[model samples]
Target: MKRNKYLILILLTWSLFPFCWQVYTSFSVSESILNPISQIESRWTLDNYIQVLTANPPFWRYLLNSTIVGTLSTVLTILLAIPASYAIARLKSFSKNTIKILLLTASLFPYVLLFLSLLEIARKLDLGNNLVALSIPYAALSMPLAILLLSSAFQDLPLNLEEAAIIEGLDLWQRIRLILIPLISPTLASTGIIIFLFSWNEYPIALTWISKSELITLPVAIARIAGSSVYSVPYGAYAAATVLGALPLILIVLLFQRQIISGLTQGAIKG
Candidate 1:
């Protein structure tokens, strides 16, 4: 019992530590974040958030950009992946296995290697300073996993239903629209939420490519809290922004928890 209690305490601390620090820091003034020995409770103020949120470019704009990018990326990813996943699942085509392998292999490959290439492409396309650049990378990054997940859901569905529909002279589109989409919706939703989180939290790419301050995402805006210059960063506002940034994800997970749980648990094992 003692061991279990200790382990639980350790896990809770590990999980909550960052949030705790963020909350403590967010309430801290700009001076405290810069000072190593600053007392946590002594430096509380609303100025950091005020400064961070109302700076020349503003944090609210960045939050909006993040929302747009995350939402659009998730929507587009689902739209594209759903049809492709359905095709791969149902069509026993010659190239189906190869496509799946390629998707898996690409997903396994680290995104680090392609950063330079993506950067170059972004510059050429004039997408470097815009949210569009991040959206493409986010979609590309998520596609492989989406395919794999959606494939499982599709496979879990009994083939007889498909065969029956075909026998009744239902065309491919009809079969997909009528039969597959409805059955595998939970898994599809899971893929969408996962992709949205990836897009929402992506920081490194945003840092490198986003030069216009107006195009800042939440992560980059929060980074500014630590100060790029020798100037002090406001910790409290950064904490608030962090909380604000996290709220959507929390809601999404909570809202979909049941479906995600049921779908993943009952998902198809065999193709």
Candidate 2:
């Protein structure tokens, strides 16, 4: 028990070290950051945050844009995934296993490889530079995993429950609406949160799809901070931007951790 506790402590520290460093750097003077152990009279300042907060379009704008995109992406993913998963869950075992394997394989593929083709499609469809339009690709990218997770969740339900609903004169839509959804709500919430976080942090697609500064997402906005000047790297400002960018995701995990744990636990147990 003592060894396990030590291991957990070590792992937690290892995981949190980078974020803690960023927090420390965000408030430190550039000189202090460069020479951490050196005795410096002036070691801390809020100029980094000021610079990040005062930029054109402002740091908060990026957060807003990311939130919009992430919310839309999560909604779209869940909407499509729920029905698809239901259909998949109702399938015969052989076909279901085959399709699930295909989905798992597809999800394992590096998504970056598809960006060029996706970019061309975005241009053809006039989707570039539109934040709302970005949700489409985000949903598509997230679909396979969402469907797989949701299907596992759906399959975990006993067949008699839906059969009973059918006997009660509930149609397919009614059964799904009144029965499956409420039971699977935790998995749905967990899936939506995961998709939202993915959309929030996605950089390659966002970079290729959004050119206007105001429309850019958080990841791109932070990248701009790092590349704002070539001569000097604003490490402090970049750290501050990173901290700001991560705050929303951190809050989300803290707030919804129970759903995340419970959903994953249920899925694992029954999948």
Candidate 3:
């Protein structure tokens, strides 16, 4: 038991070291950041955060943009996945298995491979620089996984409850709305969070779609900060930006940890 505990502690520390380093670097003076061993009088300062926040267009703008995209994408995924999953769950075994297999294969395909084609489609649709429109691709990319998760959840639900609803004169949509969704809500919560996180941190697609400075997502904005000057990178400011960018995701995970755990546990056990 002690050995297992120590092993878990070590693994956690290893995984968290990078984030801890970013936090430490965010507060440190640039000189101290550049020379960690040097004994400097001003080892820490708030100037890094100040610089990041006070920059033109402001740091929070990127965060807000990311939030918008993530939220919209998650909503779109849930809206589309629920009905599709329900329909799939009701299909014959052979047909259902084939569709699930196809979705799984698509999900396994590298997203990067689709970038060029997606970019072309975006241009044809004139979706470039549109924040709301950006969510379409995000939703599309995440759809397969969402469908798979939601379908499995729908499959795990008791058929008797659905039959009972039907006998009570509830239509298919009504049953799905009032009965099935509530039962599989935990899976929805887990799936939504996963989709939101992906949209929040997505870079390549956002980079290609959003060229406007004020409209850039968090990842792109941070990348710009990192690459602002190749010769003398603003490590402290970049660290501050990274830390700030990570804060929302950390808070979200902390706040919804119970739902996340319950949802994932139920999905794993039931599915």
lDDT of 2 by residue, 160-266 (tens): 99899988999999999899998988888888888998999899999989999999999999888844677789999999999998999999889888887887787
Off by over 4 Å in 2: 226-230, 264-271
Local distance difference test values of all predictions, in order:
0.79, 0.92, 0.92
Q: State residue 197's C-alpha deviation in candidate 3, in Å.
A: 0.9
How good is model 2 by TM-score?
0.95
Clashing pairs in 2: none
Error of 3 at 243 (Å): 1.0
Cα deviation of 218 in candidate 1 (Å)?
Answer: 1.9
| Whole-model lDDT, model 3 | 0.92
Clashing pairs in 1: 26-235, 26-236, 27-236, 49-237
- Tens-place lDDT per residue, model 1, 35-142, is 848666667777666766667676678778988889888988888887778778776655777777888898788888888888888888888777876788888888
lDDT score at residue 173, model 2, on the 0-100 scale: 94
- For candidate 2, the C-alpha RMSD (Å) to the true structure equals 1.7
Clash list (residue pairs), candidate 3: none
Model 3 over residues 28-131: C-alpha lDDT tens digits? 99788888999877799998899889877899999999999999999999999999999999999999999999999988889999999999999998999999
- The C-alpha TM-scores of every prediction are 0.80, 0.95, 0.94
How good is model 3 by TM-score?
Answer: 0.94
